[model samples]
Target: MGLKYIEPIKSIVLLLLVLLSITFTLSIWTYTPRLDPIEQSPTVDISIGQRKNVKEIIKPYKFMIKNDEFMRGTTEQLDIDQIVNEMATWKITQLLRNPVEMNKKQMNEFFRQQNQFTLYFQGDVPLSVYDEILEIEEVNIPQFSFDRLVVKWNPKDISFEVHFLNRASGIHYYGRVTPIDTMKSYRSLVVGSEAYKNYAEVLQPDGTYLAVSNESLTIQKLTYFQEELSPTRFRDALFNDPNAVRRSQVDATHEEFGDDHASMIVDTDLKMLNFVHPAAETSESIKPSELLIDVIDSINEHGGWTNTYRFSHINPSYRYVKFQLFTEGYPVHSNAKETTEIAQFYGDDRVFRYIRPYYMLDDPLSEEVELPSGVSVANALMNSDQLDFGTVEEISVGYMMRHDPEQRVYVMEPSWFYLVKGNKNWKQYTPEQDGGEQYGLE
Candidate 1:
């Protein structure tokens, strides 16, 4: 009985040891492959919400003088004392460094360019004298007419006035001179020697004088002109109208498809569509009749081009069909020729009106897509059933579908295509490298 029990115990121990070994191997195999730390780490996710605050990082708005009022206000508000100090400092510095000299011509040219001079005359100076005065080396007469001269001068940094008047004694006399400084504070005054001497005094009837001096002048405070926004008459008209029709008309004027009858035709095929009748007047507003004619012309031109050297056949399986058209003239290459391809048309009768032949390949022997007279490519596509071509696909305008590597269907107005056939031999049809001759055989 003891031997039997010992044998059973030994077998049990062996079974336990086997199970333990298998468990250890399985645990090691399960965790043997380790992941790369960089690959396994979560990446930083940048969201659109985080970009909202980024706009605020743009530079601050800078203000500058943009109109006469702002300019006048800025000049009036300038600090006279500071300007005077700066002028004095500049003069002193220049004198210390061996005074720079300018010739009479140079001085005159500078004064004329700077617009810094005043004319002074006693009464009615002769035209000869006036001309002579203008001939003075540093004098420039006013471009506009004036009885009196009050000019801002550069060298002396002052405003001076010269008045010419007829005396009570029935004789002409000239002698009214006033310094701008006496009437107003000049932040800075610039005057040339000729201008300083010309308007230095004013003669009075009572033998008295009104002298302009530094004591009468004070620094003028600078002020900013605020810009006021006001509505124009046109804007008022729009706002006042209860119907709002005027506003719509104004808005329509700025649209590409606005009522403007003047259309820009960029057909490479030179298919002049009757967008505008010969007698129709092109104006700010485009008439619906003109647009209709244009659409028709576009379709006819495209059909004629595609049929010139190609023939397309209808596939029996595809019943209702649609045609997507593209035109040439992109990149404005003069030598480029127009080409079109049927990107996609459905065989299902549910979406199309009639099954028409859409050229899958550009073969010289293939039948061309037939088009009705005066029907635009857009209208033809939209009213496919009306044209008796096929059922129309209800795709929205501007929609596009890429069917193959070389074919794409675009949902646009039917008249948009001026040519409708893919040039499979586009490379051969491309203009010569020398740019001397056109690619296609005329």
Candidate 2:
């Protein structure tokens, strides 16, 4: 009886061990290792999609809006905050992952909407110098229209800006495009004719190119300036110490403006010329804006002031303010920043000196010269030893003086300058290019 009972308990214990072994084996075989979250790069969706039909209702809308006649525009942009807020309230999103129904957990603010991005993709159709924008093929995007596309090419920096809009959907898409060299634009746009270049090579008395005739002859129906850039009157007005020399003079030489006055004198002497006073500060400091305001005040006396005339540089001593001049509404190029036009000088919280354009063409001439395009000039400069640019600050066409070796008469030729931002790496081609050196010299 003892043996029988012992055998039965052994069998039962053995069976339990086998079952436990199987259970443990199964657990090991069926187990899986957790994987890391799938990684993906951040991307922005820039699709211009149409709203889904309202309960499948059909409503016809214009497929295209026409504004192709306008070449450039300054379209007022909708505030970014306002656009975002509107998108949020409408539960509208432009993300590609958007599904008919999404788990609430997927709604993360970190995700970007599927709306158009500031930068277009590489494969997108790009604007060309010769592109007849009106004829360009339209894209098949929802709620998107080719209408109201604003293309701006700035030859100064060789920069392009494109703004694509959908007025109906209120989508604003824009970006600064990388400029490309177009052969037609390059070949056809040179400012200097072959004759002009050849003439420029002729030696002048001052060792400069004889680009224009020194005789001061007819130019584009306008007469070249015969008189020099000189101050109109000289007067003494001393303060703080009578022993200190103080003198003021006015120049009204701008050939174009006829009798509009320009002045040159010490900063304090600005008062003598009836110029607006510089603001007083407790610490004897004058802000650039203050000087700028003083310049604006002179518009009545110096009539050529325009929105294009910008404050370019201020002297290290905080004494002088240089205002850049513009030609045909475009900024004159810098080549190297210098006094293309001297605006004002500051000393002891007063405008001590002033110089402005008192001489220019009397009026626009009908003779159209095929002036070199900004892009063409920039390209030539890039290849030439003259200027290795960082970014061209501005470009303008103006007369650069040439004189006869014998008569010493002044001649003017329309020249172009590319005002490049200054840096140590830049090679100085001429002394006139140095705006910094000008502070001490001019």
Candidate 3:
């Protein structure tokens, strides 16, 4: 028995030796690339006369505050709106091809260039023609707008309000002058200032929190159910009767004032899906990249850009995303309400239920708004009685539905939204136009 025990021990030692040999072999086989020796280049000494030619860097513009702004200049008030609009349109084009860093592109549709351009100008200032401007090393497109254009004298600062131009109304942007050094490559800008970033955060008593148009959105409106649309289509789908049930279904129940987020779209079951917030945490969180891929595919299969749809809110937390059809970059607000909670899904995480509004050929911008300054809007929020002084986190500028009773559809208008901490419902602050002139507009 003792001899057998010694033999077993000897076998164990042999196994250990084998393992050690394998490890040594692997260590030898493992390739570690050695860096090549740095060849020392001989340094050529030169006097001042023999130095390399240095091109004079002429800074076209300098940042000086005549009115607490980055740069201000006078354009002879010659169609500033048109110039600004063109610039904005160009920016929109650029956005399609190149989205800003961290911003999600819902569709993978390559936006083809229709027209070629050599150079464009704002006014007397020959702005720099740059392919990109970035926070780090990528072009940021969300920091621009042409919705509200203003040309002012005295201080001689031209105001070009920068809002993200998608179907959905984007954040109310701040204004600043173009950087002087960047003037050569800078286009007409009032929004994305190098000195000051457009504040997207909710205004607290202490200060403002930075926010984006759509961030941490757990819900997304992937392709919607496009059955056919008619005026009585909703009526026929909802009830056999058009009197009480249809009336309640068609019109907003809670809203006695402006347009409510409520809109009734006929689902595939031929039932009306009233615009209601999707239930929380329906499914576990899924990858947004995978979700976006299906969205783009569906949009393409649906006759491709048949209707220019843009992301309304791509909240991917509860793994939900929503997109609205945009007509000429104006978001169709009520087209697809957040009824994905009960709507039918394509398979596991794809949504197919959304309201299909009648697309018009002449679908232009619903309204041109003169947004109040971030400070003024904050003041209004502080003055509001309905909203509690809770820990407000984010503030975004985007389009909300306004009842267009005449056209029997919801029209999108720019509005300020405040996301109170831990609350999903955005406290909206819209400027009440009492026929009196609102300050901060030209």
Kindly list the per-residue Cα lDDT of model 2 for residues 1-442, writing each as its tens digit: 8887998899999999999999999999999979998899885332111122111111111011112221111101122222222212221112121123322222111111221112111011212210221122223223222223333344455333445533223444444433234333222222111112111112222221112111111223122332322222221211222233333333441111111222223222111122222332123454443444453343323233422344444433454555544333322332332224445655444445455433333333344434554344444544554343434433333444333324423343455543343421122222243232211112
User: What is the TM-score (0 to 1) of candidate 2?
Assistant: 0.32
Please, what is the TM-score per model? 0.15, 0.32, 0.36
lDDT (C-alpha) at residue 55 in model 2: 13
Candidate order by decreasing TM-score: 3, 2, 1
Across 39-148, the per-residue lDDT of candidate 1 in tens digits comes to: 57684331211111111111101101111111110111123223322222221010011133434343323323333322222112222223322221223322111222
Which regions in candidate 1 have their CA more than 4 angstroms from the true location?
1-159, 162-234, 237-442
Better of 1 and 2 by TM-score: 2
- Cα displacement (angstroms), candidate 3, residue 85, comes to 16
The best candidate by lDDT is 3
CA lDDT of each candidate?
0.24, 0.32, 0.33
Count of backbone collisions in candidate 2: 28
- Model 2, runs deviating above 4 Å: 1-223, 227-283, 298-319, 326-340, 356-366, 385-412, 423-442
